[model samples]
Target: MDYLQSLRMFVKVAELGSFTGAADQLRVSSAVATRSVASLEERLDARLLQRTTRSVTLTEAGRLFLDRVRTIVDDIDDVEGGLLAATGVPSGTLRIAVQGSIGARYLAKLLSAYTERYPLVVPQVIFSDGPISLVEGRFDAALTNDTYPHPGSVVARAFAHLEMMLVASPRFVPGIHGSAPLTDVDPLVLLSHDDGTAGVEPDPVRRWLDTNAAHATHIRANNSDMLRGMAIEGMGVALVPAVLVEDDLDDGSLVQVMPETPLPSMGLSVTYGSRRNLAPNVRALVDLLIEQSKSDQLPVALRHEDAALVAGD
Candidate 1:
């Protein structure tokens, strides 16, 4: 028997003092309503209603059960109502993981606006050069490039593209000198991101180097900022995210090399545990990120252009 249905039928019948009246109000036939109440009484082994030819009334036991069941049904309604209302306004901490290079350069700018818009949401971020398990880390979502592997049970939404640019310190590769094909450079040392997390995709810079300059020496760092620093110090040429080095490029600290070589832009994606039962805060952040990526309001280094050949832009 459907216990809740039986309880509801009994309550309605008792209140209306007519089995037929309760059936009409509940949109069920009188026989089903009577059987539902009969099933309830048989299960409890207690008579809950006093029936008469003219009217129906509740017994003492029926009155007590009615009060408790009313509260139970009302509580269920309150919980459902509260959850529905919460879908519109997000609250609570929203933990996110981000790639180190993007985090250092542009994540903060995006988050500043997010905070202003959603003051109640507390955001915590984890910076990783490689992939991290979102579920294991207890992250609500992760911001990453398309090169990262998507874990099972996670859903990804691509928002923008990050261009990777080949850069060298002016002190190391001055103008008109470093513009040659990568193979022409002597004693070339390529700086790349070292693999840290399991199942990370191969670095595009390393792949480019292998095909173009098989003999170039390679230096690896687990973080992009370290690669940027090494490049700035004239240690070697590095393929760094454009967003992280916009100021350096403008200040003449770094120069873009081999501008003619076209490299595929990596897509920036947001990955969440699952689309099912997505929290309001996580949804809000993802929407904000998509909006920022499409508009001109993104960081200067992240702007997309049709003519530029560098990466990270």
Candidate 2:
């Protein structure tokens, strides 16, 4: 058995606190990861981890070993980076996980520009609606709304703040009293993402609805696009991220239901595992995202409106 490989696996298992999670991160089977850690314990003649059906805990010896191993790993990474830098071109695969709507709306432009600038660097993007675990997913970085919860192993950067709007179809708005207080709107149709209301609370729209809209009816959709489509068809009102429905609102396909009550802004953040000496590709992509985020692009709704105005002119 490769002692270094076993030690690496052991450290990963300790950091994650589960063999299964470590396996997922390492791209190996759970059984293989378990055996690797076991082999390391045998070689060291120390029971490094205390394990149970519910959880895994590191013993005193394990904690000491981890501290020493982490330093060695950091040194190795620095040496590797110095050697790689000598080759002149930064080249590697960068795996990124992003939310579906943001990826669809903005990633293409950013990715196109990035590829143009770094032809040798390849990017693989994974899109999902909910947050993904950086430690479990083995991704180089993730673009998500929720910041990572754990410390020491991750770092987060604010990418952008998304402005949201509540919109309804023209037909839906005509019957409803425009001057009526937001609380007085009848048969209020609330569109939601996913089945349950996680990360939906403490939202501006949610807070407003909780305080003012007593008779509001709730509707759930699995994705933002679905919610927007339902709202555009006059099925109900949807509090959607402005970027997602700007085109429809501008084209008269949908109308802003309450222009005054803007949904509270939420940040879009990019996070990465804070491994020593981040991969060149990951570092390059992070810098690119930061640069792109600095530009003053119009909000989605305004951009859509501008397009319509341009066509008319």
Candidate 3:
């Protein structure tokens, strides 16, 4: 018995829940597919599957074996594709998910340049503000503000850091003394992701306000754009990421309320599930993202040492 072929058959059977379905996918007869899996079980002296008239289910051993088999198969495919991609051409779909705010400001330009360089590569981008689980999602990779906890099964690279700032429209600025500290502002207008959490908690701006402002009120907007628009109309002071409001700051539409105390920068990272090898397409996308990260145009936070050096200089 071909061990690898048998393993593939087993996985297909487990996934499809029937010998006929597996056989159809593998383009072989149901009998052959069934025999291969049966032979595999006999060779190992273990039954990997439980067969009923209507459905097939994995036994305990089969469940454990399936996870390992999937990893191995994925690695083999990655290795094969990596070898093929060495010829200087990468062809495949690269699916990526990113935070809504980040993607809104940067994805269009990045995709344009990436596609121009590798026309054979197709790109799909999903935007979300919530944490995306790699195991459950079909995404080849993701760009996010937070790092993953389990690095063993995933590869992660820090790409950028973002500085958030407190700002208000010209009209709102007059409500408080021009030189007052950020906390003195009343009626804060906040923008946040609509992920069910109250905008007042887990937010640095909210924390700062709670600590410093004796009298603070909040108006929560579900989307960042809505938040910005409300703030622009002189609703109240807003704590927003600097990059998102750069243009407004430049045009004097928005004024920085507290420029002295910079909000701590958050790191942006690119991550993918770590396989021993990867498909040509996935590898290509990873490489491109890494290269793009090295460029000055990408948003990143300064390293502590780098910040120290700048301060000293």
Top candidate by TM-score: 1
Candidate 3 lDDT: 0.65
**RMSD, one per candidate, in order:** 17.1, 9.0, 8.6
Each model's TM-score, in the order given?
0.65, 0.65, 0.61
Stretches of candidate 1 exceeding 4 Å from the true structure: 1-86, 174-176, 197-206, 303-313
lDDT leaderboard ranking: 1, 2, 3
Q: What is the lDDT of residue 154 in candidate 3?
A: 48
Off by over 4 Å in 2: 1-90, 147-153, 179-181, 195-214, 297-313
Model 3, 125-221: lDDT tens digits are 8876565666567788777654323212445656556676777899887766665555554555444334333432344444454566535566655
- List the candidate numbers ranked by TM-score, top first: 1, 2, 3
Question: What local lDDT score does residue 193 receive in model 2, on the 0 to 100 scale?
Answer: 53
Point out the higher-scoring one by lDDT: 1 or 3. Answer: 1
lDDT over C-alpha atoms for residue 286 of model 2: 67
Candidate 1 lDDT by residue in tens digits, 1-313: 7987787678668766789977865668999999999999999999999998998888999998887886565455345544643666878998989876664567888788889999999999888765567767889988876556654344567777777788889877753344577777767888866646444446565466558867778898878889999999998888777887888899988888877656555567778753334677887887787677767877655753322111110
Q: How many residue pairs of model 2 clash at the backbone?
A: 0
The prediction achieving the highest lDDT against the true structure is 1
Q: Candidate 2: minimum summed lDDT over ten consecutive residues — where? A: 304-313
